[model samples]
Target: MVRWHVWIKEHEFLGKKGTSQDGFRDLLRASPTPKAVTGRNLSSEDLSKSSLQGRYEISRYAPVCLWEEDFSEVKQAFDDLRNRGIRDFRRHFEKHPEEILSFAGKVKINDVNEYTLELYQAKTKEDLLKGLEIVFSKQSYEVFKEELIALADGKTRFMSEAVNRTLNGEQIHILLSLAVPPGYKESLSRVIVCITDISAKQRKARELERIGEKYRKIFQNAIDAMFVADTETGIIMEANESAGKLLGMSTIQMVGMHFTEFHPKEEREAYRSIFEKHASRGRSLSDNLLVCQRNGRKIPVLFSSSIISLDGRNYIVGMFRRVLSPDHAQRHARAGKSLVTERKVSSHAKERLSGREREVLTLIAGGMSNRQMAEILCISEKTVETHRTRVMNKLNLHKTADLVRYAIASGFVS
Candidate 1:
């Protein structure tokens, strides 16, 4: 290509077509002026025009905003700063922010393509360049400081996200990439910068954040304890305040713990099986399950869970409510067992005891000691004993084993 351009120049075929030793030269003659040229008499103005023309050609139809700037003035100031033993441009600029503003003023905008004008809502490149103070927001100074630091560290290229304002005073987000031409790193004369508008992406991010905050409030304030775990890893991703309070720990302390850690250590396999089933089926409900608190007390809870998908990954959101009474646990347990068996307990026998008495009976059927029952039900041991005596007396059961058998027969526990 360079050879063809040289041939076109050598042949003085500026605006005429003619055949040459290289047949393609005849084809190139009819085309517009090529960007590259080589000759002893090439003036700087001619080179500048050629460079700007080439930039326009390359970036005229580009989607990103392109900027050709000269940082030679900023480079000289940096050199002066270095001579004064200032090595860290970032720290120095942080303390003396006015220097960055001064350097920004000295930096020159060489050229900007059509897209740059459109992005900044400028009708002409001159308007965009002259009104740079309006185009650059305060946030842009932070990015400018970082770029200066990169130049000080001998970096040839830098990229970052920043905020800039339009001519209309509307803020826009931009992904800025700045690079110096291969040999111009020290001189900082030919710096090419591109800005990709990311205002839409940032707006979407903020919308998602607002939606997340809304759901977060719902989760934290929910009456039922809630937990979210990764479907694949079974590691707890999040836990709400209710979950932490129910288990006697801070919500943050529950995150990163294995899903099975909240359940009884002795019942790990059973709870793991339940977790795996929920993950596979995308939903689950169960009773007769035990949750272990921080104090090592196991309490019965009605657990329900459903799977949710986000960003192509699946998660399980489980909600737990502590069983208020044995009747409640028995009702859930019966609902769960109905799928496997059609056996139903007599309504008369079920209605014989109150909810509290039925709960005592269910705990007794589960072989829980009176002290364990007190801890789980948040009641005194004497209160638990009283409920137990009432349960036996109301049923006319003479022995503890008889009461257990009665509870099983009534479809309260398996």
Candidate 2:
């Protein structure tokens, strides 16, 4: 017999004695290979459990108030009203608000987060539930009812900016989101409602609206011509009524036109340089600038420009005043070194006279009658007479000869 060593280690057998092949086979048969261990099934179960736990925690500790409401009673009440031939549920609810208010008792508040208590200034959840009736004023209840009906009918998933009151009687604005959980019909659905405080946001929006309205009124009624243009492209974005009148164009026609459109072709490059320089430095004043009107009339204007920022974009705002009289035009022209020699009046006496008054004085010095002056000026005789009187009073001249002498002395006439 041959000796063989057999060693047993844990559950496996190693032979030390001489063994037959059958005995070795029997040992191999008795010890089958251990099955492969896998945690896939266990992992799937843990994942589902953790997912539900996460949802629960989120609902319980959310920043805003979250609640699950049972609307079974409200549905039943509406069904009863429908059986009584009330086709329009809204109309019925409006007429019988007391009945609708009674239906609130049937609705159950299933859960509420900590935010609910804090928002309502309640010490406990029960305190909040008890004071829920005070939260819905008459107007708020009306709004709430409409939202509830829409939610039950699956018409909308969310409603926002609903006004509510707190336990302390402070008004609060809320945005509400509604959802129906799985396996629930509309009538008996468990609705999850999320409430967010939007009181501050609503107040800010209304304030901005009021400010915009005030600015609109001021812009529309301003006396001076106003133009708003894109700073980079020089394209006109907005023009006031006065601007259109000054340019002899409609407001609609003025918009979308380039700023250079109002300048003479020869002076457009100069004006562009001035605009760019002023825009870079914040403001600029160009006196005696000639603006070409839509009717081909050249209007002497004083252009005041400033850079304004709106909605994070830079814009150029220009205010312009028309030169009404020749005297005024000459004065502005002299400032720009473009004075007209023929229209120049050197008399100190004519300095006190306005453009219209100077025109009347020059004609008076030429021996023109009031009616002739009116005809030449395309004005009424009465208006011409008024201008003559003002000129005489300003010069303290009693007679036409004295006015004519003064006009000649002032170089207003040949």
Q: In lDDT terms, which candidate is top?
A: 1
Provide the TM-score for each candidate, comma-separated. 0.61, 0.56
lDDT of each: 0.69, 0.64
lDDT of 1: 0.69
Clash count for candidate 2 is 6
lDDT of 1 by residue, 64-88 (tens): 6766667898889989998999998
**Residue 321 lDDT in model 1?**
63
Segments in model 2 whose C-alpha atoms lie over 4 Å from true places: 1-57, 81-106, 210-218, 232-234, 248-253, 264-288, 293-296, 309-313, 323-414
lDDT of 2 by residue, 231-313 (tens): 88889999999898888888899899999999888899998998777777765343447899877788776565557788888
